[model samples]
Target: MAAAASPDRAHRLLVVAMDFDFYRQAHSDLTYADIDPAGHYGAAGWREGRDPAPWFSTDAYLEQNPDVAQAGVNPFVHYLRSGYREGRAISRSQFADAYYAALANGDVPITAAERSAAAEHFDARFYQTMNPDLAKVGIDPLDHFLRHGWREGRDPSFEFSVADYLELNPDVSASGVHPFVHYVMTGRHERRPLKLDLTFRQAALGRLQSFEGRLADARRWARPIELTQLGVLAEALANAPARGLHLTFSHDDYSRSVGGSQLCVQREAAEFARLGVNHLHVFPANGWPTVRSGATRTPMGVLLNGETVGSFVPHDITRALKSYHAEGPRSFAIHQMLGHSSRDVVDIVRAAGMNAGYFWLHDMGSLCAGVHLMRNDVESCGAPPPQSAACGVCIYGAARSGQLREHELLFSRLDLTVIAPSQVALDTWREGSDFGAREALVLPHATLVPSDEPPPMRDGPLRIAFPGTPSIHKGWPVFNHLANRFAADPRYEFFHLASKPATGTTARHHHVAVTVDQPLAMRQAMIDLSIDVALVWSLWLETFCFVAYEAAAAGAAVVTSPESGNVAAFAADSGHGLVLRDEQALEALFESGEILQLSRSVRRPGLFDLKFSRLAAELAPA
Candidate 1:
């Protein structure tokens, strides 16, 4: 029985004999070999020593295996046997007889005519017993028998009488019914048992369990508030003697990198959670961790489908949120209330049931081209725009042009509070939009002043340094013109600190020295070279010039254009810098010994010291 159960056992005996006999029969037909005593009698060889007897007997050995005679028993049978136990043969007729008997006894409650028709159907099974191959391939031999076995004037398509169905299945209408009707109603086909190996099955089950556990844990950690800024949120939670503050950091410009900005943000966020800051607003676009405020990360729920659904696939958002929330944030803050894309982001946050806040970046109205005070199609920092029109042009243009409706919608929809990086930015907002002047607060840009001692001055021609990339708008042309004019005189020297050599005809100028693209090395060289004056000649309205700050911190007298927005503010406050509107004013300073005095005063504590305190205060918790 065990040998019969294996497909390999049948294959080995059957395959060997079948091949031997087929070749032997072919060899015999090709020659006249009725009887040869030495066993070789063919056209190719009739020699006495050569023999065909061994092959003939090997063929006979193949015909003797009993397993071959049992035609119905094959590998497929053994496959079925692995799942089903052997039992007494339930002949088709006997099964039908019981079926009808149960129907008649009210165990199966079908009509009398149905029972008679079913009995006729039961008689058809005898045909399938005669031809088992038909049954093996899923053809119902009994149905074939009933229609054409004896050709008893019956059409194959004739509808089955109700009596026929009831008669074939004896317990068809019985209260204790078989599973047939239920299976038929559900359209379910019988499936073979799965045969996964033990290790694989265990692994699949474990993965399913882990998925369920993570979902359960996420549900338990859901929060109700939303605060965006990490530091503010952390502080609020720490000082939450009354209620937890939902804080969020929404301004993109404020969330920039300093020496250790990322680390500071992360550490502060963790501290906030420890102090009970439950809500954190994370902007994934900025690469901030999503769930730093709380233990659970929530999605920004926006309805994204059809054409509106961009490359921002749901799977991507889900993965990002899960990774972020896994960091164990206490809460979330959703941001950017002024643009269409931001609105989409907010929608996603809201869908996750997260609290959201609107964050304003810059005054969209005055910044846009239409309302901007233009000079030859260019806007300069001559005078500020009116309060009402400041953000109007940009906002209207964005809506009209369909450029950033999503961002504009975010600004339109959310309950927003404006946070500005500088007092100037806040003032610009007040004069520009209906959002009201008081709605904005001055959150100045944070800074870090290096604590190196002022080195002694060296005797040499004053090194007037320009520390950034020389672009046209950054007054590179102005510097080029100054260097060309000064190269004619040997008294004053000029140095261009940049990544590449100065391009064009200006490269010929002797005073124009290039330090080529080394930022760290160039900065240190400036200190060692004892640079007297740092020239910042920007033609554009800069919000803040970081190079100016760095040079001032290095104890260099700064000479910048008055139009360089915050440069004037720094010069007025620090006394460590000078602002000049025209070349003549700069020339007067250079000639009157004022430049020398300015360089000497640059290292004074009152000038550079105040800058350090201002920076430290800006970075401190509000």
Candidate 2:
């Protein structure tokens, strides 16, 4: 055999071939070679093939070729014979030659004969080695073998037959049959086990634990192993070990428990310390906490021009600060900060012993809170307030005032980096603020990444989706008016979350009435309904509306008010849809049939895929 150089890099290469040593022997200048064949060929096949082999006659090929050794018996040939007994005579030589070529060219080929042979060998091996009990169930060794390879072992296609296999293995129980049968038949694992350490505190446990039960339920319906815990529950998730350790703690989910006066057990923190696990997620709730050392004040009034304006801090501020101190995580996330709070919190958290800083832009303060600025009932900034009282009309008035200044100061003070949910938010923040502009990263919002086999798109009466808790601030009145206008169109249908049909009349707008209490089910229903477009008509400032993300993930266009801040950014970049400035824009869209055009274009990848990877990249140990 010969040693051959890699085509691209001249790096040494290793080649392994069964029964066809002559082909490789001819190319002995190759890096390395391992040739052998088992089954019927035996020693006779090797002896006969090498007797007058090409390389045996060519000293040049042999001299240049690296040392060659025959490895294990060829299982592939044995596999072909198994199928041959059933009248399936596939050409072993043709298959072997093709495979040899592919492997030489740095490609791996799974031919029908090889797949059959490997599958059968797997069945016999599973029964002979791993689980002999499987053989007792009249399971056809071949079918069982195929299922084992398809499920636990990867092959391809999800289409398989449990019943056909069961006919062969009669003793296999139906109960055991489900998981393994699912593996073979659907080419999917029965369940994805998520590992969780039991020693975690109740608060931390509660957040991570909730995912465990849901993941369990998800596995029951789908052929995927969903969630698994790490450390303590490692054995439970042994079947699905690819998902590594590291528990997640969103700031919003655990803030109340950690920051409140109760001081619940910090089980997660203790577990990390005990296990020596450095990976910790400090996702905050609402907004990141901003601290002012040496001074403590409650609800201090904010002033722009020496005038007693609105208050700068809310009650949630105190709660957020408390949680930061209690958790003492290795990594901290400034949930809703633009850049100002990132610096402020980094300084405070570092002083408190936390070292790494990571920020997720849940809203506009990090960018331009003035995104909520409006004039003459339209979105406008620096156009002068309609009135002194109207100045307070901006939902994020105090936060937007000195955003650039705050961000500039924050960027320099921080050691790590910051992320925004949308490219718009990142661009806006970078352009408007000087702080860490170069360092700012764009991590979009998390949404359900649509599967390759998406649910069928539904068609019927126009199914308009409006998701949000009913409040005057969310423009429920505007939605109501639009619903009423199209109610008689017969083709129009309406779905609303946290809202109801107007009292006493069978109005055209059908209120679906979803609530936050059942967030999971509500979200699922939204996806199932396949709503054409989600109308986010918020009149107030929204950091980043998760509803629009969810809707877009379900392949629905989003029609939101431009004043909705970051939501408009989603509409612009993803080609999912647009932010309607007023009723006129809505009317024009409806009349010109552009709404349908946008609806058809709503295949934007979910924000979750974009943002999660970006956040992971930024926060990942670097």
Candidate 3:
């Protein structure tokens, strides 16, 4: 519908575009020939986004360029006639001016720098005309463009980021809050209900935070409330070893300075019992001393990682555990002859008219003076830990305090049967005790900590964990030795799952807080942190090292000692552990890197099922 152009004419327009570009360069050092002619493109010439339907069209050329258009010279006929008549010559400066004018007319495809200058002039006029804040802020009139002005979009590659834009326009940025947020705060962005106001939003966010805090607090409280009924507890205590077995510990479930023995007993026993496949019961109510009303010392508060969480009276912890699970102990087993007496203790059980007395042991304390006398490592009975005097010191001390002759006279009156887990425990018992375990079933009564998250894959420093109380007897000395010995190595990291909070720190290792308050949290944390290996470095023979099993359950490699008790035997039998002899071997083991492979080979040992079933059979009459 418009004039057509010759090939030669089209070629001439290409040169014209180059001239326009030259002008855009401020006519600085560059010539018309210096710019690429094809840089400005479209169906004809106008601009890239222009319609091609015109096909060399323009306004009535006859009125503006009669001769040039009448000759059918084609594209931009009117412009050619006006700017360059048949005999007239056009200069680059004249063309650059025309191109600049077209940019101001809202045409696209203008040079980027020319476009920016034109946009600034237009933005200032638009802001002055439309914005009310122009007078109050006293900022440059051009500074107010909500999101866009004449230049509504840009190529990201060429545009400056918001931060850079702010850097270049600090005056604009200093005017107020971020522009988008300010629009909302000023109520100019949208109309909203009362709930959307700043005050309401803040209040809602505060409530959400409070809810989360209460949830975490609830998670941190280990004591039971009214959730589970007491009937379950009576059922549990009446028929314990009705399935599984664990003994009374020195502290409640809260003490990591020892272990979560009571928690372990309650949880594992409840599980087996719920399964209804094999029998299960926690010994003497899942804690030590078969806690009667006054069998224990003052119910001490439990301190973990050095924070006092709560306190318990004698047997109150067990009461809570049973209440928590809606379960109770079915029977009572005395662990170690160390912390017992036939009168007040036995009378406490028989007072309930319970005659099924079960004795349990990892040591032959009944035959020897001290329960902790390491094999071939004693001349006379050694002293107990200063914290606890019941380790054969109070009631069964062979040579030091309580005379065995006096104990033997008292022991003849009660009915008791001793139980052992491993051949090692049985053999040691035989060497020291006059009466052997009525049943020797190689089962650690406390099941492994229930598995939660998968272990993390790691490739950096050796991450080692000591997973029991940091008690001197449980091997705090060895832990300190390792910490000091590896102080300078960047390739090793040590973590102690301490009961007490961190009092002080050494640069060698970190103290991880593993508490009874949140067993599942502890398990998940272990997996999350990629704790690599668990050290079974106890100085004494553990009746059953629940710590070793717990660490394995949490996905760490077990590096137990090749010493007495179930810790050594289980580590050896698993074939996935690094059984080192002593502290001297730690570095060598670390350097060996066998733990990396051993970590992958962990297998959960049969917890209390085998031992409990065997005990049940033994308890039955032929």
**Each candidate's lDDT (Cα)?**
0.40, 0.42, 0.43
TM-score to true structure, per model:
0.41, 0.41, 0.42
The regions of model 1 sitting more than 4 angstroms off are 1-340, 348-366, 369-408, 436-439, 447-452, 499-502, 505-525, 587-597, 601-622
lDDT of candidate 1? 0.40
Error of 2 at 241 (Å): 21
The model with the greatest TM-score is 3
lDDT of 3: 0.43
lDDT of 3 by residue, 1-622 (tens): 3345455665565555334433323322222223333333323333322211222223333335566545644434334434444443322333345345545643223345533543443434323423333343334443223222223321111112234333444553576333323223432334322122232223333434332343356447534422223344344434333332322222233223234334443333344344342222212212222112225533333221123334433254345344323232334444433333444344434433345656555454555444565422322223343234444323233242333432353345445565665566666655544542334445445454333434466666667776655554566556655654454456677776654433222322334444334544444445666776777776666667656665666666677665536777777786436677765686576566544455433432221111122332334221
Model 2 agreement with the true structure over 190-276: per-residue lDDT tens digits: 332211222112222234323234335544643221221222122222322122222222323332332211111132333333444
Which wins on lDDT, candidate 2 or candidate 3? 3
* Between candidates 1 and 3, the lDDT winner: 3
Off by over 4 Å in 2: 1-294, 297-329, 337-347, 354-356, 366-412, 436-438, 447-454, 457-459, 471-475, 498-523, 538-544, 561-575, 578-581, 588-618
The TM-score that candidate 3 achieves is: 0.42
